[model samples]
Target: MTDLDAETEFLGEWGRFQQQTFFLLCLTVIPNAFTALSIVFVADTPPHRCLVPAHVNLSAAWRNSSIPLEEDSHGGGPRPSRCSRYRLGDIRNFSDGGLLPGVDVNLSTVATEGCVDGWEYDRTTYDSTISSEWNLVCDEGWKKPMSSSVVFCGYLLGALVSGQVADRFGRKIVLVVSIGAHSVFATILAFSSSWTMFCVIYFIVALAHTSRTGSAFVLGTEILSTRVRKIFSTVGGNMFFCVGYMLLPLAAFFIRGWRMLLLALALPSFLLLTLWWCVTESPRWLLSQGRAEEAEAIVRDAAKKNQIEPPAVIFGPSHNECKPERRKAHNICDLLRTRNIRWISLTLWVIWNTLTVAYYALSLNTSNVHGNKYLNCFLSAAVEIPAYILSWIMFRWCSRRRSLFSTLFMGGLFLLLTLLVPANLVHVAVALEMMGKFAVTTAFSIMYAYTVEVYPTVLRNTALGACSMASRIGSIVAPYAIYLRSYSISLPYILIGSLTVLSGLLSLLLPESNGMPLPDTITHMQDFPGCCKKTPYKLTQTEENEPAAEGKCPVVS
Candidate 1:
């Protein structure tokens, strides 16, 4: 009846089908691409608009990629053979456009400046109305941003609780719960009657969504074979982001209004929840929870289904394994010891939070993009796909520390570009923004993998959870930095840029972790930094470290 028992019972997914389903279901977690700081922008397509100015040209703005209805727009008399329309309705015409779903618009220009000044086209609502009724503003509208911030706080709180929940309840049950809650909460937000209601629903949505992300990642990482596990885990985050990006435009195309958009996105979580009923649970978690008997049953079932005999190996870590640290019993004292290990861990956390704050805050508050927010946002996402692929390839060739620092370097350089290039040069700014995103995305991917590598096994989850919490804190600070006061306050970006550059310097101070096995015990932890090859690590029991610790590590590196 204990969660540990339930956990052990579920890990033995011997059947190939069970394994495949478990692995495949990870795709369900990938829709977080539209996760800008939660102020749902007006979709390109509005609700029903009765305004017909004698012509209905169908071109998307430069920021949008939808094909133009040039004939009607550019005085070609609505002929199909006419050149494509380059613009859409002005802000004055931003009323509801009838819900007719067809093509997706991928470009918008205006103040976004992806296009030149004269071509600063107005955004047209492209798709159909999402729902019968939508609330443009929740009551007590002042709380919208705070309501969204609740999502970040939810993530922090969820990370704090997730380790225990997943351990006690079992990841499968936990995932199902999170999935169900996220769907329900998000769906309710669509029908929110007041600001209080929206805030409450969004808070629930945040909690569920946050826990789901944690569980899904843990599941995805564990399901893979050891040889491929680390790389695949990193890739999972990267791949899902691309999928999420595509979903954004699709949401734009189908859900014309905010409520419809929210509801449509919410449905997918429910679909994922339903899909979970048939998928097998993680055998690893089950084993950890001590439900050996149930774990065996699942494996036996898997063996029968796959038509392959089960291996004698039990669901336990290999002897060569440096068992992961378990620092999750809630000791703030342990975290604040401010010694080498804890401090390093906290520094990494700060780095992560700073990066997320600047990255998402900027993306969310791109107010200058007047014409087509959809296209501007979409293009930004498209640029991120390569950033991930490149990270995988390069991280393999270079040490994690160097690869991470280089990415930071690139991001800082781009941030500097944003500062120096001046605002009037919109195209240059857009290019710089792409460069900045590319760099940051790469950094984001690598840091997650590297942070895990740096920590001892027993403390891994606690360490990571702490880092995630810092990231949330940063997330909170980032939005207000961009959205409040002088909204154009470039200070956030500048500060972010400087911190990132410092992070690169800090990265240089850390020991490189190429080809090194993870150190699992603190008894083994303090010795690791100076022992790396290239900066080879070796220690004598009598002394804290040897002369090699003080010298340039011989790269056994």
Candidate 2:
């Protein structure tokens, strides 16, 4: 019998054992959610202007009016210049002349100079953030978003090594180690004395955090039956991630300091350490590693907890055969060795990178979306709930490829619509952005499942690892995408929208996997309808080693 058949007999779908394990694993995603986007608050830049030095003898009105007004480079609104002030000497002279502040002082004619005295931040919303503490304003504005990019760079570095290490050292060990390391570093990140120190520590925190979350997700997924896999991934994992996202705004509302906020985000991981006692290793992983005895023991334990009797022979005899030849692992070269698989691999990478970039671009842009930052963040996260539900429903009722592409295109379309919205109608623009966010959220959920379905099992994990690394690269670039607002406010939306639509078009070139059995080999993968040459794929053992032919894609069945 196959692994799925054995899993059905031994564990049953959604049994008590599965539910318990899923819940424990899902709990871990909460803290991950907090850390992933905590930068939104931690590095937030509230309304600010150059500080009016106390030493300058100026009236309160003169002090307030001293900062010259300038046209916003991004949105063209009139606002006080963040990095400049009316020349201090001019203000000092005006005050010395006994002219009351705001009393016919042609402030526009006054010369302006770079702020010599740093800045004063509006504290009504946020008491303090990294942007305020480090004066990362004006000339230093890029550092705010770059801080996030630094974390994602760490994610890229970790993705490079974590999967191979997890596959070799076991998922549970890596998951636990990453969690501990993430927590420790995250705590240190809160106490950062300099922006450089924060970036360095945050990088390590991101690496450990991504590694832990990825391993936990995979471990939880591998142990579940196919019947509930989609639900667990979409509703359980993605929805729970949204829950953490939603909670961030609420937490920030009360805890206004950036250091305290980072502390809050970091502290939750310590609580996650408790799960090490409750969560079990993946039985599938054990079997793959040829530890059949441990695999059976886990299955039996699951059966007992599920209140079901195990069969006398819990595992098939094939599980006990230690074939050293079967231990050979496929590498990146294997994914590109075939024509159909290579095309599918490249297309999948595009979709992954596009979706991830667009998703993070929108997520990071919430602060600039013309609403209460906390409200915008909450609404942005809240939208993901319905998005995940729609994803779950779509996976159940629609073609995976169609739903995936449609959602991506629709998201792009909504973001594109934002450009036509009049600048005065900021509320309308924000609404459209939220709609785009909802669609992108749905597409993200669909893409995760669809990617797994596209590749053969032998190269599945490797393919996913590659795609995840691509995603991290996208994330690393996402901040700069959002930063484009410095040039034009519409640029970020236009860029993300255009790329998302292009990704939808690219997705259409790939085969649909709905209702199809997963391919087990490169030959089987190439044989899938719409992924092959006009001629049927039949590879002889010797021919199988050859590079796939280029430049042809069969029509979808």
Candidate 3:
């Protein structure tokens, strides 16, 4: 195969064609923002208490005393019990003589019972959520977290399947199919009559969304030149995701009902179908498959769009050219077949898991923050803008390993700081949480670019998929991590902070790939050096011209 970056050098890094393609790919990520975190609003649990029966003849003051106060879980003082009520029968009997409780009759002896008649929700914040409509609180409270976990489960399945399909079929087809499926299922999810039906459809939506996102990331990176690829991966991809996340809270604020909010989010995805006509397959991918004619045609069109004249032979004869009979088919198993690649893959999986857990744990915890839920969510999403910008700057000048390690360490440190914040200073706690989010968002953005560079093109998507699949283990644990806040306000922070710090230490073991050409084959990865030592392999004259040949070092010096 031709060195794809060198072969396409005539088109320039930021030509008209490259600019247009980058914009369209980034657009696909916006709707996915809504799909990934909309559960924050969809399953929100409003303040609620046991319902008082209308048949009980009692004054307003007497009715108010029917529900007993319980100790607040967060040390905020006594509040109304969510799942229990003082026995109404005892209250009614005590009030038969029109005697008030506490003064005339002792109410301490009264026993409490579960909310048998159902509960009444406080709809000040949300007009209606799945929690209020279906009563997913108390005994059925487990279902809310289960619903969030189901989405991550779908993500795990999508990562496992989409990588293989994209590698086999093509990136364009996978992107098209995944986006269309996500739109259809998300729209269908809005009209669900039962929670069971809703969860099943939501799972499919999550699966399709994950596939669409992975395919878009791989396609964007492959099509752009090495210099532009870093920009596209770090800033271009995640900035749009942040925009969609910010928009979600704004949309949910106006459309407080869950069904309508879902409809508003899903309907706009159909506009993305136009991408099929504008987006082309990755030239790098086509050449790797030995479809030189197709790759050349796309290259010529890009040259024409950029108003540059192409040479007589765009791709010269080279040793890297693909021979179908001689080429061994690559699969997920290939990731673990070698020593260097195996260790790299294992290290990446651990890093990905830690980032996923910390990132989602902070994002989902916005609802439980002390201020207005909408404001908290909007601020959380807004903080990612600067984080991504900082990531792009670091990618341009700093080492990938050092950038990742610094961000993870700082993020963990910020989260740990939350434990020392006084309970009375709610704003201080919120600020620390956002700072943690900012740092993790930066690390998460860097991880995307760094992982793509670590593997060869043949197994890039497959490796990314496998690593993504592993990260779902953390995402699966994230909702429950947030749930831990109910037990002790500090438990979630302790868990997330400790894991994040540990992952940063693990990242030091991987090799640095700054300014290195993307590896095209397993042989290329084998020749590459690790962060700590040099392989000291000899290269042919032709190999000397390759980009990866320039960056084999024993240490930073």
Error of 3 at 554 (Å): 29
The residue pairs found clashing in candidate 3 are: 1-320, 1-321
Best-fitting candidate, measured by lDDT?
A: 3
Q: TM-score for all predictions?
A: 0.70, 0.91, 0.95
The list of candidate 2 runs beyond 4 A from truth reads: 74-77, 99-109, 456-458, 518-557
lDDT score for residue 433 of model 2 = 92
The lDDT for every candidate, in the order shown, is: 0.56, 0.79, 0.86
Task: Identify the candidate with maximal TM-score.
Answer: 3
lDDT of 2 by residue, 49-119 (tens): 98887877787778878888889886668998888898989888888887765556767678898878898
lDDT per residue (tens digit) for residues 1-557 in model 3: 34567767889989899998899999998997787699999999999999998877877767988888889988869999999998988888777768787788766778999999999999898999999999999999999988899899999999999998898788999999998999899999999898899889988998998899999999999998878888899999899999999999999999999999999999999888888999999877776676667878898999999899998888654323445344457888998898778888888999999999999889988899988999999999999999999999998889888899999999999999999988898899899989999999999999999888878888989999999999999999999999998799899999999999999888877788776767776666633235634342344566555423432211000
Clashing residue pairs in candidate 2, if any?
none
lDDT of 1 by residue, 335-386 (tens): 5554667656666776788677767765665533433666777776777788
State which candidate, 2 or 3, has the greater TM-score. 3
C-alpha displacement of 547 in model 1, angstroms? 34
